[model samples]
Target: MSSTTRILLGLALGAAAGLILAWFDPAHAARAVQFAQPIGRLWLNALQMTVVPLVLALVIIGVSAANDAAASGRTARRALVVFALLLSAGAAFAAIVAPLALSLLPRDPALIDSLRDAIPAQAAPAAVGFADWFTAIIPTNAIAAAAQSAMLPLVVFALFFGFALTRIDATRRERMVEFFQAIADTMIVIVQWVLWAAPLGVFALVLAVCASAGASVLSALGWYIALLCAMYLAVTLLLYPVAVVFGGTRLRRFAAAILPAQVVAASTQSSLASLPAMVESARDRLGQPRAVAALVLPMAVSLFRITSPMQYIGAASFVAWIYGIEVPAAQLAAAAALAVVVSLGSVGLPGQVSFMATTMPVTAAMGLPVAPLGLLLAVDTIPDVFATVGNVSADLTASSVVARAEGSSEPAAPA
Candidate 1:
């Protein structure tokens, strides 16, 4: 079976087992949870250890790639800016909307407590006032921030460090890129290794959580999935307005042209696989020149994935809700920034890898516990499809915007 399938099967089996214990024998449920928690913790730790380095490495590599793309021409530079703005807006939207959505859900204080009791959660760090928090964003020392798991500051530092790499000699930059790429690859290997045990880990975790938290746990997750679906759909639909107003494409024609690419994205669950269709839609249906489509579409596929930031903010907000922590506006804004940075850095990773690698930084930036992430990841299969659809649609939307900006500056056909 596919790894996702196996992990989900494990989740189902564990939840079933736990529910039986909760209903039938409390004493056995207690023992079973004590036995299982450590195994799950170990798996989570393995995954957690990789996050900092992997993010740093990927951010550096992504910066290098984006630098190369921007150097290609004015069109590439404009497109990158558009990608950043749209991603930031989507993330900011999620940051506000997800918490609002979570608040409207039925709150069972007892259920929340039981879920917390299911696995011991780390206490959130003491809050700092705005002055301290704002200054900390620059990180007085990067290594110390990372060692302390001060993700927001460290991520900020990494962004600066990545940009600095661009000013060095080209040969030196190439070497540094190779080095960080190796780090990223190594981290991916470790992630894959850890995930191989995901079935067992998910089983242990779900069993313990379901036993204490009761079947009400599923209701919360159901709500989260539903929220994510609605958010992704909303983002996808919003792109239509963006393309029309900024890209200057007709609404009906843009809709018709993008349909084929959106179908390909939905079916394949891959923007890369949908590229040819997106190019065709851009050139033939939208009347974008072949040259414009060729440049913008490919670059969008490589270095941009709009939904990545949205998912990060959404996950962080959901976790904040589960723990009953009220994230301050400054912290939520910081989480939004972290979400955008990580999305840009880790843009093109596989859904599973990106979920783990990118989302954790945003959650950590918000000072939320990471314990619940594995269960959430197990259930991500449903939302990931829509995330891909939104991403591809955003890609086409971005290309149209770039084409509008570049109007009549180039030939109608590829040189």
Candidate 2:
């Protein structure tokens, strides 16, 4: 069987086993999940271990491989414009649609009380001024930023380093590019090796999560899950039409090209793992120039994250609805803005870890409780598949859009 099939099987069997165990005896299942927690942690750690090195290598190599600073800057500008537009649309969709969908679900007073009880008695986070956020992007120490998994600062530093490399003598620059290319290639190999254990890893991770939460947790959060899935579907369905209309991609062709990558992304719930497939789709299927695909796709893998705004906004809205908190229009706008900024800055973090880091601050900034985030994290695994699929789809679509805009029909000779 294919790896994708195996992953799906693992997810199904794991969730079934966990739910069955939980149904039989919640306490025992929790204990079992606790015992299996290390396996899941190891899998996550293995993936996380590749992130910092992989991102650093990709950014450095991508920038260095560019034709020149002008070309790179133009590409960056176009890609960011596309990313920002799509992200804003997604955020608006989530901010409006999610709350409406959530409102339709019958409220569970018991679940509400449970979530309320879970809230920690802590003060709301201090307001983060615009100046604070701007300064935080340029880290004083790159090492410290990487150590703390501060991906935005790390990315900024990599961009600067990569740009500086472009200004040096050709021979020296080529040597440096070759060095980072080797590192990037090495990390890709490591990722493949790590993913060899994906089925087991996914099984253990889902089993642990399900066993800890039990079937009741699933039932209680069913509506929230439904809302999230709906939002993902809505965004994904909208993406293709946009790609077809504006990007000039054929719908049938786009689907056929992107399906393999989407399958990998859905199964693995990791966009990074699907990067190779996305690049292939962009270059061979969508007819993007090699230079454009190489530059846009790798950077998208680290930075674009098209589904982030929707997911984060939906989560925040759901939390507010559940807690009976009244979020005004102004606060919602602020939350959307914050989510966009955080999503862009969330490069290189593991999937769930990235969600939490980006979402918690929004929750805090909105004056909502962060306690229910644990529960959200528990159930986020299933919806995360859809989210990853959305992200991968957007990545390819954006590449196609940027490539077309650059008027590059044929593959550019490699730098």
**CA lDDT scores, all candidates in order:** 0.87, 0.71
Which residue pairs overlap in candidate 2's backbone? Answer: none
Q: Where does candidate 1 stray beyond 4 Å?
A: 125-128, 409-415
Model 2: residue 112 alpha-carbon error in angstroms = 2.8
In terms of lDDT, the best-performing candidate is 1
User: Candidate 2 — which residues are off by over 4 angstroms?
Assistant: 1-71, 118-217, 411-415
For this target, which candidate reaches the highest TM-score against the unseen true structure?
1
Q: What C-alpha root-mean-square deviation, in Å, does candidate 2 show against the real structure?
A: 8.2
Give one digit per residue, the lDDT tens place, for model 1 in 1-415. Answer: 9998999899999999999998999999999999888988898999999998999898888888899999999989998999999988998889888999889987778777987888766776577788877987998889999898888888888889889999999999899999999999999989989999999999998998999888887787888898899999999999999999999988987888899999998898888999999988888778886777899899988888888888888887888887788887888888998888788877667667879998888888888888888889899888878988999999999998888888753322331
Clashes of each: 0, 0
